[model samples]
Target: MQWNDYRLVLAVARARKLPEAAEALGLTVSTMFRRIERIEELMERPVFHRERGIYTPNEVGDELCRAAEQMEQAAFAAERKVLGSSSLVSGTLIVTSSEVLGAFFLSRHLTDLASYHPGLDVQLHSGNEVLSLAHREADVALRSSRPMDSSLFGRKLSDIHWAVYGDAKSSARLSASSDFRHERFVGFSSSPFADHMSAIQRTVFPDGIVSLSSNSLVLTASSAQKGAGLAVLPMVLGEQWPGLFRLTEPIEQIAGELWIVCHQDMQNNPRVRLAFDALISGIERDRSLFVGDSV
Candidate 1:
């Protein structure tokens, strides 16, 4: 099947419905269906099972989808490599990091990095999910801990410290007491922090009274500032919010090093290298802030 047709099936599998996939690909539903039909006709078999608008990839479809993905990546890599040879550093730099890191740190510096290279496009995806560098999910990643993949190269830029924080009113009311069980707690919905929170529940808040829980640290910090409960937040973020106050010192076990990671193959690519260096320098210059030292 043609690359475009293969992509159509891939999109259908991903979106789980022909109509949605068509919308995403900017094609009419009939056009999308006809394209897939042509693909299946060429293959002499069905690739996907359809039920009530939901499309599930069969074995053949799965294989084709994998091949299609590899082809797409190869095409993109070719384009990137062509740009890499150009003296002018200009291309898309996809950087992934946690919501807290992106919002408080990297996002602010991205504009300046792009301005330094006018042709560069910066896509800063703020989420906790670790995108695979080896798979080319992102050009570079800023993470709390070093990547486990050997194919990746990384630099530890700074230490990220976590501390208990709450609204100023709660701090004023209950700051004297070390036993925080009397106060409501705010915690993450998921992360390596979940285990740290377990320790906290056992040692600090025995009642397990968590008033707010979310995947977004931004929301968690806001909740704490509004007096919802006490939340464990990155010091860089917690300190900047005037409504919030640190309830205790930075936690040690839960703290992790801030790392800038990327695929080893991209080390020589000018845009990737430049963006990577910019990230390291920016974070290095602001290292004290991440470590809870006020600038």
Candidate 2:
């Protein structure tokens, strides 16, 4: 019922151990245990089940945790709206996106924004896994696919075009189509074209023959750079690393759209808004590089 209880549940779910959850929350293990007992006592049922010291959330617990997350997001959104434009805007702006955008794009824009607003602190997260925005895992998110949350704002930023890429040393082995199918392919276990939650992985092998599949675009690019395989990468990424060659024409590459999603609660915060604007502008400036039919 309380935010603290909800937070404790979240931490426990993440850590999967009482001690780990306690440590995460800076509380003693006994205190954590007592909190769980209190929740269970109020509900007249156990929310979590333990097996071999590992805690797993029961259906009720999962539902409560999810509801708690929504409540927290609403609370944060309300707080941000109340602060409005006058707020000093000093807080961690947690941004999440695919590794490619996180590693190559987000940092540069944040750096530029930092010079303008030194008081704002930024945390950028990039990985194949998408963080939960509704849980406040990230204040802002850049995604390759549209967000399903209707309350959250989602906007198409640009189309991401991908091409067969290899380093200059591997150029000799490249010949567009067969070369791509023959060489090792780097891709996520799930892609946009597949049943993955997001589409970042979907375009890796538009031709459909991935010899070597990995969840990491960075790993894919790295493998291509090392001649370990052929990778589909954005033009900007290839340009950033000299000697990486495009094996096919730009029009022949696979492309998908980019989207910017933000929790409604954090939308009005000046810091969050500024970063969102910066991201939009940055993508617009380089729109030509990504491959897709429409922006």
Candidate 3:
């Protein structure tokens, strides 16, 4: 089968649902259905068992998936090598980060980078999901955790401190009592960091009620500002909101480091290297802000 066919099978196997797989490959569900049918016809066997809109890959499908994964890795390595040898500083540079950091802090620095390199195009993808540098999902990333992959390069920017925040009234009310169990909180919904935050809440204040929960830190911070409840937020974000007050000292258990990371293969590319240096310098200049000393 062709590479496209292999990719289609892999996507279907990964997503299980036709619509999601189609979305990942930028194809309509109808198109995906048709393509799969054609693939099955060409192979003279069924690759997937379809039941209630879910696709489960059969043995042949599993074999194809393994081969597809190998092909994908080889292609990515080839692309990385070609890109790494390039000395050109002009091209698209995709930078990924958490929504809060991208909106509140990283955007300005990215704009400055764009201005400095007139030929370079800077794309900022802000989300809670950690994009893979090895997969080339993003060229660089500002992450809460360091890269564990040996194929990637990571630099610790700073330790990002977390603290409880609330509006003036909530802060006053909470301060009146040492018992945190009686208080309410604005917590995170489903996200990469939500489970960790939930664990911290359970351990520190098991009886505290989550009055509001959202995946967006910006929304959680806004809820706290409006007195929805106390929220655990990064100090850089919590301090910037006008109506919010830091209700507690930094919570060491929930604190995490900020990292600037990229695939080792892309590290030597002039554009990637330049962007890395710029981001490192910018983060260094604001180290106090990240570490909660600026407030």
Any residue pairs clashing in model 3, and if so which? Answer: none
* Cα lDDT computed for each candidate against the true fold: 0.78, 0.72, 0.85
Q: What is the lDDT of candidate 3?
A: 0.85
- Candidate topping lDDT: 3
lDDT of 1 at 89: 74
Rank candidates by lDDT, best first: 3, 1, 2
Which lDDT value does model 2 have at 148? 80
TM-score (C-alpha) between model 1 and the true structure: 0.84
Please count the clashing residue pairs in each candidate, in the order shown.
Answer: 0, 10, 0
TM-score each candidate: 0.84, 0.74, 0.84
Over 1-295, each residue of candidate 3 has an lDDT whose tens digit, in order, gives 7899999999999999999999999999999999999999998999999899889999989998999999999999999889988988898999999888888668757788778889899899998687988888899999888778899888888899888788989766666235577688998888777988888987877889988898888989998898788888898788777899876767778778898898989989987888788778887777655666422
Instruction: Tell me, by TM-score, which candidate is best.
Output: 3
- Clashing residue pairs for model 2: 77-265, 160-291, 161-290, 161-291, 185-212, 187-214, 191-201, 191-202, 192-199, 192-202
| Model 3: ten consecutive residues of lowest lDDT | 286-295
The runs of at least 3 residues in candidate 2 whose Cα sits more than 4 Å from the true structure, single-residue gaps closed, are: 1-16, 34-51, 54-74, 83-87, 172-213, 251-253, 292-295
Candidate 3 regions with alpha-carbon error over 4 angstroms: 17-23, 26-38, 169-184, 189-191, 202-211
Report the C-alpha lDDT of model 1 over 1-295, residue by residue, as the tens digit: 6778878888999999878999989999999888888889999999999898889999999999999889878876676466545566776788998877887788666768777778888888877577866556788888777778886778888888877788868777766346676568876667656766667655655765877787667888888888888887788788776788877767665677888887766767787788777877787667766776421
lDDT of 1 at 28: 97
